[model samples]
Target: MASAEIGVIGLGVMGANLALNIADHGFDVAVYNRTEERTREFAAGAGELSSKIIPTGSLEEFVAAIRPPRPVIIMIKAGDPVDQQIAALKPLLENNDIIIDAGNANFRDTMRRFEELKDTGLTFIGMGVSGGEEGARFGPSIMVGGTEASWNRVSDVINAISAKFNDEPCAAWLGENGAGHFVKTIHNGIEYADMQMIAEIYGIMRDGMDMKAPEMAGVFDAWNSGPLDSFLVEITSKVLATGDDKTGKPLVDVILDAAGQKGTGRWSAIESQQMAVPASAIEAAVGARSLSAMTGLRAEAEELLGRPDLGRFEVGGNAAALLEQALLAGKVAAYAQGFAVMAAASKEFGWNLPMPIIAKIWRAGCIIRSRFLDEISEAFTKTPDVANLVMTPEFSRIVKETDTALRTVVAEAVRKGLPVPALSSAVAYFDQLRRARGTANLIQAQRDFFGAHGFERIDGKGENHGPWNMGN
Candidate 1:
């Protein structure tokens, strides 16, 4: 007789925590790792939940522990490792057994794996599991994409281990094959933009306004009680206020300025570009990270270019309020761009992604969880067909009200020679989108003149070529 309801492969932090979470929910979970020592360690450290978990020494034993039509959850590193694990497990699994990838694998790879495994009588699920170690141990925001029948088999366990918003589980079956990973990719892209914009505001507070880290932390704390309330902002406040135990200096002050990435943000930007969607804020955020990585080049450039006298510039007394408003506006733009990319991809790929459901799931356990998402969820719930988020009444009003503040912040950043690419890009995107007659007509004419690319007329239909009088 099969001993466990589900089996988890990989005993890394995420995988171990997730397996323990399943056991905590009263499900019998079988755990395995490449190294048997890690599995032994996890089983030994499982505390009260130890009895519910079975530690397996081999892949075959792990497979044998689970019930028929077994669900094997893979939580290994993305890319080649995931493929390797799948190949190793395929022979051990019986027909109708399910393979669920709960890593950050690319959507295309997920789709390919789904196709490759279909004939072998195994169901493949690309699941995007977010909310770090703590969330994994308690509850996470789960985005799953696979066949309906396959989802039905695993939905109960997934729902039990997911965060809840208004009594509804944060886990949802997004669509077929790759939709889960694709949505997760976009989530990270939005996260990039959100973080960059916050950093830009913090830069203004630190450099332009000459505020101390603790003072800035206080401001962030205040914002968390209002419209800006979110996981990132809340943690940012704590990070800024934290002091180094040895030196008694603000922890953030002692930390390095260099940022690191794991490619999800870059992938989102690339997807947006390929789909012809304007995700300028997300692109700018990715560019900012790339620029941050070149520390030596920046140091050399600063020496060569000569540092400007930033002391001469003075930001106004309402800088904090201005920053809050500006950040809100930039955030709206960033989310709008992310959603637009998703909409375009949905149409292209026939995913039929539910915008409201996406927003709802993101409200609790995800990194980018915020009160603003609650508003967004409501907007989509009311008008599911809204092409752009900014086109919705609530978002439009927020953007319009915050428009002047955004302009002021960007103008001040430019005047003080402070880099605010994400903020500035958001402003530019908003202006361009709102413009009735853009300069694209001139670009079209230039294209027509140089490459014989026909231009569309304003009044008439069809592409028309311009007659250039060139001296022969």
Candidate 2:
């Protein structure tokens, strides 16, 4: 009967919730999972929402359930699975039927898929869905990358099912082909840095100050009222306050120290490096995760080198306040680097990515959502073409105000032998960025001396290379 307004493939955590969200918004959503049992189970569990959910057992049934010029969301694992799904769906879908890849896909893959489907008349959207399971069940920040026509066709449903900030929908067509996924990659990279920095601060509080989890939770809860009011901070407080069921200790203490990551953070770092934008904080965070996974190696190293016992951690004033400011400062640096990478990517891809709109949508329904993003929206709105985000007046003031705190925090952490790679990288990034003339001249000279690669003469001299003696 083609009664469903949209169709969702895959019944994973994200896909199921997204389908429910669509159905909750008064739209009939046809759903299909590779395993028919899961699809039936989802429908049975939907309860009241089941009326709006069309459970299809096969791809043909799923395709037949949707209306003409269908908008089908492929919410499955990325890479080859996505390609395989597309190949399977091609013969079934008609011209103008939209296929949306709502996965954590690499932008390069998105671009390649777009190229492959250009002549097929099947509109492809590389979408980036943010916020976790809860957000997916309610609403998420949706980033769509596709043709304007395709976006226009689906904007109603997309807008209806997206999170709102002050009555504004947190969904937008960022750019063509891979733009949405690219932004999402950088978003995750920033998330990595944000989380790592927070952990570093918690390490200081725990190991240095010998503070308990509940006490730290109180401080984090307090910070949530201030500039650090974000989803991550709010959750951090909750996680710290939670007690373990078995041992009655803080839940965090009983948990493993290691962390796992998908490829998005690494992609962000790789893309930033390829674009010649220094995202040291993001890189450091990635490296830290890799190191964390080496549990045996870390344990062996600890046994051999011994934990640093350099005495009580000291700051001139309130350590908590200093840590807060330092966190804020590190966040600014990480965000600046992320935005700079996006800026470079935009140029390289000719996406003309809207900086303010990106910040605007991120203000809600995303992991990194915060009061600071609202400020970022304003800054970018005022100075759209600024060389870097840190150069904006609002962020510039923040960096300056928090500079001393960040310096003190990093200095103390280093002295106490606390691992603060991400935070320390933020400091080095800021220092290197602010320097008018860096030591790169010596690097150029060294390169020229070794390979005769040539260097630019500062005073407009004739020869570019140094006349180093070959005999020496």
Which numbered prediction scores highest in TM-score against the true structure? Answer: 2
How many steric overlaps are in each model, in order? 0, 0
Question: Model 1, stretches more than 4 Å misplaced?
Answer: 312-317
By TM-score, how accurate is candidate 1? 0.98
Mark the 10 consecutive residues where model 2 has the least summed lDDT: 461-470
Using all chains and alpha carbons, the TM-scores for the candidates as numbered come to: 0.98, 0.99
Candidate 2 stretches with Cα past 4 Å from truth are 461-463
lDDT of each: 0.92, 0.94
- TM-score, model 2 to reference: 0.99
lDDT of 2 by residue, 1-472 (tens): 8999899999999999999999999999999999999999999999999899999989999999999889999999999999999999999999999999999999999999998998998999999999988878898998999999999988999999999999999999999999999999999999999999999999999988899999999999999999999999999999999999999999999999999999999999999999999999999999999999999999999999899998778997788999999999999998999999999999999999998999989989999999999898899899989999899999999999999999999999899988899999999988999999999999999998889898888889666877796678
RMSD of each: 1.1, 0.9
Instruction: Spell out the clash pairs found in candidate 2.
Output: none
